[model samples]
Target: MNLKARITRTGAILLGKYVACDGFDEQQPIRVVTHVHADHMLGLRESLKKCEMVLMSEATRDLIDVLKSPLFLMAGNVKTLPYKEPFEYKNEKITFYPADHILGSTQVLVEDQEGERILYTSDFRLPNTPIIRSDILVIEATYGSPRCIRNFEQKAESVLVDLVDRGLCEGPVYLFGYHGKIQEVMEILWKNNIRVPFIVPEKVFHVCKVYEKHNKKLGRYWLARSEYAKELRSKKEPFVAFYHMAARRRFIKEKAYKIFVSGWQFQEPIRQVNEKGFVIAISDHSDFEGLIEYVRKSKPKLVLTDNYRIGHAKILAKEIEKRLGIRAIAVPPTKPKKK
Candidate 1:
């Protein structure tokens, strides 16, 4: 059984013949999503234009639908498949397992009819995060360097609180994070007694519902739209508005205190937001050690680097082979430009 994977920055991988990891590559057919972060879903529009089928969890489909815009307009045809339901494509049976990276996030398992299985861990966190539990272990090591191997959840939360308490601004706390970490942060705020009427954009509101569907609690608030005027007017205290990065610009005009969240906060976008808004490096991707450990367990005959840290992937692939005698190969080619 021969397994091949082509990793793309949009988190789309050409797996075997007909299946794709994420994104809308004109070259592939079916696309499977492990998570809905922008990088993963960036190329989806083009994918739907060329492919016939797109597979994702029911909750993820709903969230994608909620995020209707020019980017996701072509996603109308996405078919919702329940987690663990093995489906046939290109004569291969593929299954999705929960990865606990964020809401509706999953780790993909592709198996041939002859029972050869290949697992793709697209931006995953092992042992789970605050809101979700890690099950099948295909993990992402965006932070998979030795320097990021410590538990920073408590410290991260305190940083947010400290910013608010330090009188950065006496206004609505606008925290910018993706759908993956929003609910977890909200739960943390609730647990820490951060009393505020949290506001979330409609898109993220739908995304948060999925977390609630899995029994994870978001905070005690709603959207800031006029429809929720009663709730908005009755707000007794300031609240956190968990939103997508795009929504940050508008919130800034509302005179609300702003915050940016992510594991990649040290990078350009998040860092830019930090200079203008309160920022924290609460990451969902596994650190370097986590990535090495998880990949070692799978024992694949070859490994593919999923486009973020190519140098790291190449180095780690060699280390895996040397340490375990299992051959690991990095998927070649850089990111495809948007057409």
Candidate 2:
């Protein structure tokens, strides 16, 4: 009846010996993928190879069908479970909740036979995110620093639209981010009534089609090399081009504006890098305040902040203990917790 939740040195989230989340651990038989982001999919191949079964949301599964090489979804071990449906194993039950981070992102809650619960908030934004209660809470520390709070989060959409509007007035505007994030910006433009044609790379076009299949509406867009896009380019009209950050470069020749969309900036939501360059702090993950707020709402007795990711894990653990009076620790540490 001893159920534990902690991150391993290899960035694996192990719930006892039963489940591994995001990362992979051999001892864990079931692998639960929270999302499709590369960082969260560490040791995914190993997990798929050795683990008994791999679990993810249906959208996450569909996304893998598009993004991965050699057709990843064709495997029999991969399973897609709907949200709020508890799947019972030998002596435990697991459930998925919407993470609000990406298309198929989720927060996992595992309950032992004795009713002890452990919730993993892998990557999520606080807005409209459900707070799942648990005895042991394992959370991401991507924006966990006390000073990492974004005051202008509510204004990110407006700022982005304004930037695009101004950029489009002059020439074609380029928007860059990861898969889900760039699609989010596209939805924002559509919602704000930014009526200009969208041109995206091949993979990006496919990802947007997936979003549409999931009932997420995006404005009219075309593939970069398609005849429609070429026609729009010939017109010399303003168009927005979307590219994943990894593939972004000097592809467009005209005086086009470039905007990098990410959540790393803390100073302002919209940061002007140069005359034609801008950085939008429109993040998918929760900020420091949102992380703390999740902790406060869930009221977990023991909290573990993930130290494996890029942000301030130790600082978040310290802040959690100091501010919420909860027993908090950063995972994969050298020293044992002082009880």
For model 1, name the residue pairs that clash: 12-22, 13-21, 24-43, 24-47, 144-287, 144-288
Find the 10 residues in a row with the least total lDDT in model 2.
330-339
lDDT at residue 125 of model 1 (Cα atoms): 66
The prediction achieving the highest TM-score against the true structure is 2
lDDT of 2 at 124: 91
lDDT of 1 by residue, 162-278 (tens): 765543246556677777777778887777777766777677777677677767776666765745634554653455667787676676565556777767543322233444465
Q: In candidate 2, what are the lDDT values of residues 1-339, reduced to their tens digit?
A: 124887877888887549999888978899999999987888888888888999999888888878885466555389889999999888999999998988999999999887888999899998779999889999999998978989998898898999899998898898889989999999999999998999998888888888999999899999999998898788877899999998766644446789999889988888787778889999998999999999999989999988887778899999999999999988866433322
Question: In model 1, what is the error at residue 41, expressed in angstroms?
Answer: 2.3
Q: Give per-model CA RMSD.
A: 5.1, 3.4
Error of 2 at 142 (Å): 0.7
> Which residue ranges in model 1 land beyond 4 Å of their true spot?
1-3, 8-11, 25-28, 69-77, 129-141, 158-171, 227-237, 249-257, 265-277, 308-312, 318-325, 333-339
